[model samples]
Target: MKVFFVTLGCKVNQYESEAMQKLFEASGYVRADEISEADVVVVNTCTVTAVSSQKSRQMIRRAAGANQNSIVAVVGCYAQSEPEVVAAIDGVDVVVGTKDRTRIVELVEAAISMRNEELGIRNEQPLSVVGTVDEIRDFEELPHAPQRTRAFLKIEDGCNNFCAYCIIPYVRGRVRSRSLESIRDECLKLKAAGFKEIVLTGIHVGTYGRDLRCQVSGVSGQKISLVDAVKTVLDAANPLRLRLGSLEPVELTDELIELIKTDERICNHVHLPLQSGSDEILKAMHRPYTTKNFAELTARLVDEIPEISIGTDLIVGFPGETDENFAETLEFIQSQPFAKIHVFPYSARAGTVAATLPNQIPSSTKKIRTNSALEISRDKSKIFVERLIGRTVEIIAETSTDGLVDGLTKNYVRVYLPDENIPLGEVVKVRVEKIFHDGVWGDYVD
Candidate 1:
């Protein structure tokens, strides 16, 4: 049998899809390059925004229609959040959610058997294995190995902070951390697989150990923090470079900062999401930190790690965001030492507090703000790249096309080299030459 996968959403979702692929492959199934050629089609979904959910639905329908005889399976956050909605879609045979993905192959096999028994007749109801996310306590460990230069190891799952604009907590459940030993094992495997970099990813990575107690002999009732997980990955994998997923500003403790500063293997880039710069809008969104707190954290990071690249997520056009509020946000982001900005117009998800709040910003206004923020982001990115000119940086060559190799530096700068002979997946030094398309062009050094 051949299996084709359509993956969407965050890195965590991608990791899960990769794990499911391994399971199917291990069970003697070949991977199908085209959806139409597969015996089974799996659609791993995302619901971070309404747009994402719509895209998930479209992909599921497309996959289902691609091969008439294929067993269609839908999984991940979108499925978890709205199982019935997904099951109602035509040609869907199996519907699993954020939980119980380890059994996905078995579920697909059973669905396939049922389809064959019925002479390829569609089942009256899809096989749904979704459970309440809030009740989940332990992290589900899925077997995965890197197929690329950089491997993403998910050390945590779920979220506790119900940010007013987010639907993630409801779909992903509370914080469930993977055991340190499990992390070590995965790191060892990645190291043995010869991956140059390992990125620690999670729904809320900074909240990694919030739900677990320490297992050390001397430490009693002490909670394991993200710092411990980082230490474990460093000790076990010792990869050429290590990178962190998006982190909450409040959870970036002093100890973690110190570790990032002292550890040479750890990348000098941090994605601390400052959802909104306006304190009023932030409070309305129920984000815990104030603009003052976020400013201080970024300042400290810059003061200590002078060469660090700081990136952020900004949500503009929140409910009740006046002109003054937006001006404050624009001024604040400009004053900061941000290397990049990911701008999103406020998307009010259903079942969230912000959705029902008064004075919702109009779509036209949101569009205007989004474009303005994007302009700033482009300018900031160009400035950051300009600073890298004539400097040598290490990059793991990731892709090659038309005699040019593309890669990313540890600090998250995209560098393109002219020589395609630069081995993919190997760290090579490159001297920044000039700015290219969306990144910088660099000449391979040594």
Candidate 2:
């Protein structure tokens, strides 16, 4: 049998899809290059926004229409949040949620068996295996699936914070951290697989180990933390580079900061989501930190790590955001030493508190603010990359084509080398020469 996969949303979702693919491949199934050729089709969904949910639905329908005989399976956050809706969709044979993905292959096999037993007749109801998100406690362990040059190791799952504008907590459940032993094992496997970089990803990465008792060898009963997990990965894998996923500002403790400062293997880049810069809008959105708190944290990081790159997520045209509030946000963003800013127009999800709040911003207004913030982001990115000119930095070559190789720096700068012979997945030092396209052009330092 051949299987095809359609993955959507965050890195976590991508990791899960890869794990599921590994399971299918190991079970004597071939991977299909096209959707129409597969015996089974898996549509991994995302529901971070209403648009994402719509896209998931569209993809499912498209898959179903493309291959009538293929067993169409839907999984991930969108399925977890609305199992009945997904199951009711035509051509869906199996519907599993965010959890219990280790059983994906078995579920698909059962679906295939049922279809054959029914003489190829389509079933009215799909086999759905969604459970309540809140009841989940322990992290589900999935195998390490490395991408081309970098390997993503998920160390944590779920979220405890119920941000007013987020629907993630409803679908992902409370914080459930992976065991320290699991982290070490995965790191060792990635190292043995010759992966040069390992990125520790999670729904709320900074909240890793918050819900778990110590499982490390030396401290069995003590409370574990993300710092401990990082130390474990470093000790076990010793990869050429280690990068962290998106982190909450409030959870970035001083100890973790110190570790990043001292450990050269840890990347000098951090993606901290500052959803909105206006304190009033932030409070309305139920974010934990204030503008003052955010400023202090960024300042401290810059003061200690001079070459660090700090990236942030910003939401513009939030509900009840007056002209003055928007001015404050723009001014705050301008004053910060941000290397890159991901500008998002406020998207009020259906189940989120912000959706029911008064004074919803109009779509036209949101579009205007989004464009303005994007302009600032372009300027900030240009300035950040220009500063690295003439400096030598290491990048693991991720792509090579047409006599050019491209990779990202420890500080998150994309550097391009005009050499096709450079092996992909090998970390090479290059001195920045000039600004090229979206990144900087560099010459091999060796």
Candidate 3:
């Protein structure tokens, strides 16, 4: 049997798709390069915004239409939250949500063998959040283990924050982390698989290891906290740098700051999500941390690690977010001068508190705010890249692009070195010469 996996949304979704691919390979299913050729095509969906949901629906129709009789399946966040909505469409044969991720291979097989109308799986499973932080499963060993320069190591899953404007907590359930033992073992496996960089991702990475929330750090040799899990892995690791995905500002403890500062293998980049910088909007969003604390944390991180490139996500036009509140967020972004800004205009999600809230901003205003933020983003990014001129950075070459070998700096900067000899997934020192709003160009030194 041939199967195709179509993925969308965040790193967690990507990891889940990879896991499903592993499941299919185990069941004697070969991966098909094209959706038309595959007997079963799975559309891993993301519904963060109305646009995303629309795009997913379009994919479902396209896949189903491409091959008239092909069994089209939908899974992940979108499928979990709105399975009936997806199934009501013509193409989708099976709809599995976030919980039964490993069951895709079987479900696909069953769909092909027995044609049944299992349309609505929405809210069919347990309403209570289900997952374990201690029992970590790294499906990296499955066949076709992501052949790439950068690998995603999912150390954790799910979210507990329940941010008002977000639906991930509802779709992904509560926080669950992979075991410490599994993490180290997987790191070794990725290293052996020729992956130079590993990005640790989850819904709410800050809540990692909350089940037990305590462990004896080998580096400390003391009964320490769970926050040191990354540190412990770093201490034992000989692999290249490990980068972190989006982290909540509230989760940046003193211990974590110290770990990044001391550990050479830890990347110098941090992706901190500041949904909104205005305290009023933040409170409305039910975010745990205040803007004051977030600013203070940013200052401390920069002060301790001078070369750190701090990236963040910001939401504009949130429900009840007044002009003054939006102004506050813009001003804060300017003050912080983040290396990169992932700007999003707030989109009301169904079954979320913000959906029914008063003072919903017009879609026009949302676009305006998003555009303004993006202009600032370009300027700030250019300024950050310009500062790297004449400095040599350790960059892992990803691939050759337009006659220049492109890669990422240890700080997550896209760097282009003028050498093709440097193999993909191999780290090399490159001296940066010019900076563009898009990326940095450099000459490879080592």
Candidate 4:
């Protein structure tokens, strides 16, 4: 059988889809380059925003309608949250949520056989494969890494912080961390497979190990922090570089800051999502930290690690955000020494507290505010990359085409260099020559 996959959403989803592909391959299934050519199609969905959910539905319908003979299976966050809706779709043969995807090959086989046996029977009974989302209390560890120079290693899953504007916690359930031994083993495997960098990713990465104890490791019986997880990978795998996903400002404790400052192996880039810069809006959104607290953390990070690139996420038009509040947010973000910013207009997801809140900002206002913040982000990014011109930095070459190679610096700045027969995934030094499109043009050094 041939399998084709359509994946959406965060790095976690990407990693999971890769794992699913491996599962199918292990069962003697081949991969198809296109959905139309496959005997089995998997639609890995994302429901982070209404837009994402809509796109997922569209893909599922298109996959089912495009090829009537293919077995259409829907999985991931959207399926977990709305299995009934997905099942009612015209062509979804099998449906499983976030969990039980490890048994997807078996489920697909069973679903196909059942459908064949009951060809004329009404498709009344839904596929009996849905897994309980909340019952997932243990971390799902998949030791597979997608083929890439940098691999995203999911060390934790789910979230406890249900930010009012987010639907992730509901779909992902509570926090569950991968054990230190599991993480170390995965890292060693990825390193042995020639991955140069490993990115620690999760729903709420900062809260890793908060609910679990170290198991069968040197740190056994002790609670592990995000720092401890990183330390484990550093000691066990010793990859060229280790990167972290977005983190909560409150989780940037003194110990964490000190470790990042002292360790050169850890990438000098941090992305903190400041949903709204206005304290009033933050409270309304149920975000725990204040503008003052966030500002202090950024200040300390810059002071300690001078060359660090600090990125942030900001929402433009949240409910109850008055003109003054927006102005405060705009001013606050501009005042910070952020290397880059990811601007998002508030997307009110159903079941989120902000969805029912009054005083919703208009679409025009959201557009204007989002554009303004994006302009600031562009300026910040330009300033950050410009400063790196003429400096020699270490980077792992990722892609090459037409005699041009592209890679990312340790600070996560994309750098393009003329092809020098440099092998992909090889860590090499490059001296920044000048500012190019969105990044810097560089030449390989030695």
Judged by lDDT, which candidate is best?
Answer: 1
Candidate 2 lDDT over 208-257, as tens digits, reads 88887755577768888889899999999998799988998987899999
Ranking by TM-score: 1, 2, 4, 3
TM for candidate 3 is 0.89
Q: Each candidate's lDDT (Cα)?
A: 0.91, 0.90, 0.77, 0.87
Please, what are the lDDT tens digits per residue for candidate 3 over residues 1-446? Answer: 78888888888788778878878888898899998898788888998887788888888888878876677878878777787677677756777777766666766666665553334322222112223222343322322365457788777777777789888777777766666777777766775675667777777777777753344245333333336557645644555788877888977888888888987778889998888879988999998888899989999999998689999998899998888888888888988859999998898899888898999999999999999888888889999899889988888888886677888888878988766577877878888899843789888784
lDDT of 2: 0.90
What's model 4's overall lDDT? Answer: 0.87
Tens-digit lDDT track of model 4 for 17-98: 9889989999899999888899899999999877889999999999988777888889999998788899999878888888
In angstroms, the error of model 3 at 329 is 1.5
Q: Write the per-residue lDDT of candidate 1 for residues 1-446, one digit (tens) a residue.
A: 99998999889988998999999989999899899999999999999988999999999999989988899999999999889999999999999999999999999989988877888898768899998989999999899966667899999999999999999999999999998889999999988888879999999999988877855447768979999999999999998899998998998899999999999999999999997879988998888999999999999999998589999999999899998999899988888888899998888788889899999999999999888888888999999889999899889999888999999988899999997478899988999999999789989889
Query: Per model, how many backbone clashes are there?
Result: 0, 0, 0, 0
Model 3, residue 22: what's the lDDT?
79
Top-TM-score structure, candidate number:
1
lDDT for 143 (candidate 3) = 27
lDDT of 1 at 250: 94
